[model samples]
Target: MKATFGIKERLKSKKEIELLFSEGKSIAKYPIRLIYREATTEKNFTIQTAVSVSKRNFKKAPDRNRIKRLLRESYRKNKYLVSKNTTHHFTFMFLYTGNKMPDSIIVESKIKEILQKFISKEIEKQ
Candidate 1:
């Protein structure tokens, strides 16, 4: 698989987003929280994902956008960890919960850790 974040990998449907929040299970690895559930739709990809940064943490739009960008970049690069060896399709929402701005390296490492945790947990369930 190519190391690319395509549009198809984005979670855009309002109903799906609602379902994800309402029915998903969450795993938090500090700074980042992941909410995920098995996809209801028969999509092609292994996962579709969205990202969020709390307005309460950063009141400015630029600050939130920057953090979101870092989250996306990290996930885009490391998402293969979740996709590989998984037969299930999932929808994921990644939320930033830290009060202060974090470096991209911190976000990336945390994301890698969380994704690995997610994969391990899912494997055990199978």
Candidate 2:
């Protein structure tokens, strides 16, 4: 199993997401929108994750950070599974579209479930 998500595991910039969206395909399961594009590189993938809590929900940075942290941690732990299923590498973005910040445990569970579905989708794609 891989040990790290590394620099490439991150969905660091907007251009990456834009490129994927313009050319790549997407799958959404509410609160989680997954945009993925095949990459030419081997055993290399990039992921950008986000959670949405508008001014109406979280009025503070800390509140927002708390949610983002959970999402990231959850992804970091389970990313290797997604990483291994690639015949071709992929760049993926997990967007949080929920209206408010739920419990961290719930968010973590949701992230894992979402990732599992993503792996399942990849199998179907094959």
State the lDDT at 3 in candidate 2: 57
Best by TM-score: 1
By TM-score, how accurate is candidate 1?
Answer: 0.97
Where does candidate 1 have its weakest 10-residue lDDT segment? Answer: 79-88
Q: How well is each residue in 1-126 modelled by candidate 2, as lDDT tens digits? A: 665556656666677567877997777666656667775455444444433344555678887777677767777787777767765667776666677766767766777787788889889878
Candidate maximizing lDDT: 1
- Candidate 1 local lDDT, 10-126, one digit each (tens): 999999999999999999999899999999778978899999999988999999999999999999999889888698999999999999989999999999999999999998999
TM-scores for all predictions? 0.97, 0.75
What is candidate 1's CA lDDT for residue 66? Answer: 97
- After superposing candidate 1, which stretches have Cα over 4 Å from the reference? none
